[model samples]
Target: MNILILGSEEDIHAAHLKKSLTEKGITVDYLDTRLFPTKLKITWQAITHTGCLIFPDGRKWDLADINKIFWRTFGGVNVPKLTDSYQERIAVNDSMGLLRSFMRSQPEKWVNSWEAYEFHKEKPLQLSLANKIGVTIPATIITNNADEILEFSQAFKDVIFKPVYGGSHTQFLTKEHLEINRMKLALSISPVTIQEFIPGTNIRSYVIGEKVYSAEIRSSSLDFREDKRAKLIYLETPEDMKKQCLAITKAFGLKWTGIDWRFKPNGDFFFLEANFSPMFLHFERETGCPITEELIQLLTS
Candidate 1:
């Protein structure tokens, strides 16, 4: 079986997966999206009515021929020294757009298409989906109006603010004591998402095909990255929690994803969000789970 592990050169999990699949006698190839040249051609095949991806190097990697495609990253490269944003945007957009169409052509096998992977980038949409799946979610509000912010703050007393779009520019999930100050509204020009603080323990559920594992993450600070002094610990999750993790992944049409579930102080599981392509090696070392082997089995099956 031929497998393609789509990711960036900096992605550690993708590297590990490639090693595991190779050990299992699968022909695994790594395609770093950043290495894709600025030029690519997409042609519609009249016979199949599907788009074909042609690399600038003249190598043809057909989507239909791939036994499995583990999408490790999507739309994450910055063309260095580009003066024009339009040019850079076009290059990245075209690559991902073509890649998305290619993946959509496949009807079977384990694959994480760009469309399925993109669901995690939107926090509000994820929360809505979680609610529909009978998973507990915190109360949230998105608005730019000053009056609305004040009202929600007064009602909820304690709230956490995060960006609607996921990016590294801002921080996430900082536990703040209720101190309603209306002037903070002027900090941004866009609508801000404020949610009721769901106090709980942090748990991450890693799902690859039918193999699912859950681990509790313990961090002293609300924003784990903020305080370097803070430490992280991983603990195995109960069997019932593993079932919930699997259900969440299937609902997202995802064969591989890392789910973040917070156990609130009230002894309940609240769905935070899913990481479409999460790092597995480090987690496996901490939790002692054989995620790499499972990925290989799915591709080879």
Candidate 2:
């Protein structure tokens, strides 16, 4: 079977997956979004719904032959030092537009389709569904209003904040951050997601189809990722928790997802966020979960 990995060529996760798939005697190719317009070409016939992907070295692959597309990354050269800014935007957008058109026209074989990407972007909706499912979730608010931010911070004494759309590291809302002027200036640029900070073990559950593999991430830092020495240890998910994880994944319409949680001291887990394209090489290596194997199976099947 020929599988397409939709990700950057430099993405370690994609590279690892390519290696694994190739070892299994599967033909694997990377569809790095960044390589378009400059190093590659795309063409499609409207009437026939036929198309082929042209690579840099004159190699072309008929789009129909692709068995499955492993949805990993979406977007064109995220960091291109093009000579012209305006032109760069046009180039990237144009390339992405056509690529998306092709993606939209293709048959349904995406591991987690473009729709999953849309669902992931709406954190508010995801959290709401989690809460409705009876899953524990921290009280949270998303807004750019400085007054509301300060009010929420004051109400929940200990609170943490991050980007509403997910990018920056989570930071505690400190006493000094209560200043309206500072918050107004910073938040005016973009909306911020502030949540009541829950102290507990950092847990991540990888839901692949009907299986849920979990791990306890140990770190001294507020954001486990900030700690270079952070460790991921395998953990058995409680039957109840497993059901919740599966529900969350299905609710999100995700074929594979990484659900972050906070296991509070009271033996309860507070739902954090669900990652549609979470990196898993580290989790697999440390926890010995068959993450790659399952993903490969999903794509090849």
Candidate 3:
């Protein structure tokens, strides 16, 4: 069987998946969206969608006949503008819209289709669904009123705020901005989401197909990702939470997911967030688990 992995050059997970698929004797192809072409044609079924993709080299691929697509981060494409003009940048912006049209046209196997994954991206929706599934989630508030913020802070005392739509972590400026404004969250254009910080240990639960692996993250700081300068402790979670992780992923219609949970001093658990696509190497590094191998098995199955 043939499998197509769609992501950017910088996607470590896709690369890991490639290696695992090769070892499992499956034909694998990489299509970096940034390398996608500016003018493409695809005739699937009785319909056709024609558009252009500003590929890395101005090259295009006719993508109507592809079998399976593993969609990843959209902004992964980094094609430098030839003219550095506003019009040129606008063209690049339009390329993603066209790409979305084609990606949804065919009824093929998608590793958690964009449509399915997008629903979980909304922080409010995720928590709502998590609550319905008997999962314990931290009390959350999404609002612009300063009074609301103060009220939440008073009630929770220690609250952590984050952007509803997150940006790339590789960028230093984005990280600094998030950390700097962790208090006010006033300048935010969109509604800010704040949760009562659950005290205790942090865990990243990875669900790949039916298998579940939990990695405990211990940091002496407020946010682990914030202070990388701090020490980190990683370990596998207990059996009960492992099952809950799987249940959370299934509840969200995700074939694969990374769930963050915090355990309080009183033995209570709080669901932080469910990441549609999260880093896997950290889990592998902390625990000697074969995450990539499991992904390859699911793809070929």
Best by TM-score: 2
lDDT (CA) for every model shown?
0.68, 0.87, 0.67
List model 2 lDDT by residue over 246-285, tens digit each.
Answer: 9998888888999999998788888999999999988998
- Candidate 1 lDDT tens digits, 82-137: 68989878877776665555556673644676667666677788788878877778
Across 1-301, the per-residue lDDT of candidate 3 in tens digits comes to 6667777557887887777777777766666665543323322333444432333444444453344666656543344576768876776666655556666664346777776667866878888888988888888887766667666666755667777766622111123433436634644556667777677977777788888877667676666686565433555566777778888877787788888888777777788778877778767765777777777766767
Instruction: Using TM-score as the measure, name the better of candidate 1 and candidate 3.
Output: 1
**Per-candidate TM-score against the hidden true structure:** 0.80, 0.91, 0.78
Mark the 10 consecutive residues where model 3 has the least summed lDDT: 168-177
Off by over 4 Å in 1: 35-44, 49-59, 76-97, 107-110, 168-188, 227-236
- Sort by lDDT, top down from the best: 2, 1, 3
Task: List candidate 3 segments past 4 Å from native.
Answer: 39-67, 76-98, 106-108, 168-188, 229-236
